[model samples]
Target: MEFFPYDVKELFKQIESKPNLWNRSAHEYRNKEAREHDWKAIYTHFEPNFDKMNRLDQKEIGECIMTKWNYIRASFMRTVKHGPPTRRPYVYYDHLKFLLKSDVKAIDAPHLDNNDDTLEQIPEKKLKVSPFLDEDTEIF
Candidate 1:
């Protein structure tokens, strides 16, 4: 199923309105039953005409939404959160800013220990050359 840009934007709005769906620390986020209930509610809201008779259909709907959600999240992380100054912000960056309200850091700094002596103590191993690649070796 194809989702229009408007639908996706509205979907993000829906998720934003419900903290349990987006907030990682929410108790409902970790609760399987609560999470499934929320997804069922979301599915009904977006798919009023469809009937969720089988578990597969519900799972498929959830997967589709998750794929889109992940894409939006990854784009926000790359463009707005970690992008260069010249890079343009993602279209939904403002809509999803609530996601960053928690302890989410924009950029993760690399952990570096400035110990030069430790590097010098390690010896490099010599690699054995493959006999098949050598011009002096013949294949039987």
Candidate 2:
């Protein structure tokens, strides 16, 4: 079954219930088994309509959901890193504002900041004059 915009919104709602799918700091997000379990929960939510033809397998459904999630995430990150574009933001932008909580930390993360130490120059060693060296010798 083709997912309409509303269906996608419902999917996001389901994702909201499962932090592993969106919250990176969640322990489940780092655990492969836990993540797969959460994915199963997400895919199951759409089983009724999605499996009407029994054409889509669990993996396919998971991929489709993840693809949508990735697109929305990328769009959100863009708006966060840069300002909103001339066009309006994604339809679900407001619904996904929860992302800002995590993204704000990432935006202000230390790695993104410029360090003063990196700008400091190391002292150069001075060359000593050798008494035995010929004056005619060209350093170049």
Candidate 3:
């Protein structure tokens, strides 16, 4: 015996009693009636657009289209080898400002080959710096 949240028999009985009203706005009714329709009926659907200038092979053309669409679907539009790249979408700065601040990297810190005091190498000389003083000058 299988279990369902709603009674299947009762739902069907309700459908038999009073048919549901036609909801024109409903997405469920859209292009659904012809879902099982033959795709080849659409002319543009089979057109070789990927290799426009090159001599197209029928097998390669279909494979290219299928790969873009269905073959190993998880990778979608991206090639599997170029696995989902690390992208910083929402940035604190604008694209131009971000490019200007590209020198600062979180983990790309300057390292010394010698296992010496990297911090002590810097002379403790206090200097007052202000962005308002010189806009052209870059801070280290």
Candidate 4:
């Protein structure tokens, strides 16, 4: 069985232990979700104009896109490597961010190297041809 962080369980237990605490905690948790949703709405304000953006702005947009792409890729890697989470407060998102920020370059470097090696391994072949050969050649 998977285990949750001790503090998370402790907080849940505390809320369950008292009726007033349970009510307050439930309200606070729901409000926290609402706040996060509002914050996400604010992120939309930074929308970039692809055509008008300068090189640096484009680069920044590219980096953000790459970061999110890497996060998704790393999440899959984590699920494959560590198995699925079984409890609340799973650290998958945090782990994804960490891998995107730190491990992505190293993880992708090997794949790039392998691609180069594969290309290099293919043998170069040359076919011989007559420079002045006509369209038709007479043969008995």
Candidate 5:
């Protein structure tokens, strides 16, 4: 609702009469009352100039000129993002980054519990050592 102040109508008149009005930077339009009163006139001249701003660098002069406009644009962007956002459930699963499903299954197979066959494949403990005594040195 708020905007910067500039003498657009007077300048427009000056241009109409003099035919050689000097172009000024958008920063010069920092009059609060004038902006509130003559926003339509100001926008009529300035809005088209918005398209010319392809890069952020274009807006950034020495001391941040278009504060209100920038704030409104940022607020609008935060409220209504353009698209569904650049997001993906899975980014990349190339062979170099991770092994295939089959390879993973094979690698994990040894750790997983299987039927009787796999249990039987495990070596059973043949000895249980007493905590007090060493197996290599017997008590004589």
Candidate 6:
């Protein structure tokens, strides 16, 4: 669970070298094309925008990377705790980067408050339900 700060950078380099680490059938079919497209999009999105991002935004992205790095490390720990896979190296670093980048936007989300709740409180609806419910009903 202890992720070094450079882990993400190392992962990016590894992913660039070995883009098809997962080796799914879908990857065999389309990964080359898809990976190119994904890389292009990532570059387009991040390259020019890098300088525009504030220090806070960069910090948020770093936090996201750390969070996902720890999560993947924890998963690896669990995998080892249970048993080794028939194959070695069950997860790839790119998988962790993918997870981190996917969630990075949420970490960088702006804290603007919409005016919906400024004037008045929205009424809460009360649902009538029996405290003791048999196994038939689902709460959700």
Give each model a TM-score: 0.61, 0.63, 0.20, 0.28, 0.17, 0.28
Global fold similarity of model 1 (TM-score): 0.61
Tens digits of per-residue lDDT, candidate 4, 4-73, equal 2124333323323332321333344456565444333322323425547677875665455335434545
Q: Pull out the clashing pairs in model 1.
A: none
Give a tens-digit lDDT track for model 3, residues 1-140: 22333333332232222211112233442454432122222212355253353445645544453343232222321322232345432222121121212112211223312243221232234578875878678777
Give the lDDT of residue 106 in candidate 6: 27
- Write model 1 residue lDDT over 49-68, tens digit each, in one string: 43645778767776787778
Query: In candidate 3, which residue pairs clash?
Result: none
**Superposed model 1: Cα runs more than 4 Å off:** 1-6, 50-53, 84-86, 106-140
Which residue segments of model 3 deviate by more than 4 Å? 1-43, 46-56, 76-85, 89-140
Q: Point out the higher-scoring one by TM-score: 2 or 4.
A: 2
| Candidate 5, 69-95: lDDT as tens digits | 344334333322232134321222111
Quote the lDDT for 82 in model 5.
34
- The 0-to-1 C-alpha lDDT of every candidate, in the order given, reads 0.62, 0.65, 0.31, 0.39, 0.34, 0.45
Number of backbone collisions per candidate: 0, 0, 0, 0, 1, 0
Kindly give the stretch of ten consecutive residues in candidate 6 with the minimal lDDT sum: 105-114
Candidate 6 Cα deviation (angstroms), residue 102: 28
Q: By lDDT, is 2 or 3 better?
A: 2
* Residue 104 displacement in candidate 1 (angstroms): 3.0
Positional deviation of residue 97's Cα in model 1 after best superposition, in angstroms = 0.9
After superposing candidate 2, which stretches have Cα over 4 Å from the reference?
1-6, 49-56, 108-140
Model 1 per-residue lDDT at 74: 74
In candidate 3, position 113 carries an lDDT of 20
Where is model 4 more than 4 Å wrong at Cα?
1-48, 87-140
